[model samples]
Target: MKAYFYLLFLIFSLTSHGSYGQRPTYSEDEIIVKTVTDEMDQVFKSPDFLKKKNKQFQDITGTMVVDIGIIQSGKVATFYKVENTITNIDFINFVSEYILQHKFKFKLPKKMRHKIRYSITF
Candidate 1:
């Protein structure tokens, strides 16, 4: 049993800090991340985000991905990257502003900050 536990710990230690294929550098931060929760569904659908919607473009319809960074205080500080294939400034701004208004349900431990990737269909 002790050997099994030791092996498990070894696996976790080796994999925890290993980044595959040039992942974003979080070396300086002692981050603890959890999957986005059901509460985020409400945040995403809330009136705050809906109010910024622009339906002016009939031809543009797809998923927009954003990597949002949140400080340990649980507030979204910045969007590291926005993946809009069409490069629509208005749509990007709408999403970015909407995300800034919301906070993550999960709080990082040890006052560490982290980033999360999310997508919304337009």
Candidate 2:
């Protein structure tokens, strides 16, 4: 009886002390923006993209603020809006199309839809 009581106590203590495996929490600025920034940098720094950008958008210089909405699944971007500062229509269209066609690799919990603001500098 004493051994059974001790074993029960041990089990209860261990279970209570165990972590419940909660999902990691992130600040919006830290994870979401950084993920977008990293992906944008990777895409823009590629030689092929660079060549095209230089050929077509060499003189373009401005900052574009993008509002991106992430789906609840967080693996995909639901929609995005570019607050354009540059006057080049073609450049704006290209950037918008690129964003629209791309899927984000970073994923978050499906608890809620997430939105983030990102800026691109040229």
Best by TM-score: 2
lDDT of 1 by residue, 36-83 (tens): 434455676777545545444445567777777877656788875566
TM-score, per-candidate, Cα-based: 0.56, 0.61
RMSD from true fold, candidate 1: 11.7
Clashing pairs in 1: none
- Tell me the spans in candidate 2 whose CA falls farther than 4 Å from its real position: 1-29, 72-82
Write down the worst ten-residue block by lDDT for model 2. Answer: 18-27
Model 2 Cα lDDT, one tens digit per residue, 20-67: 543344447577778777877787677876787898889988988887
lDDT of each: 0.62, 0.71
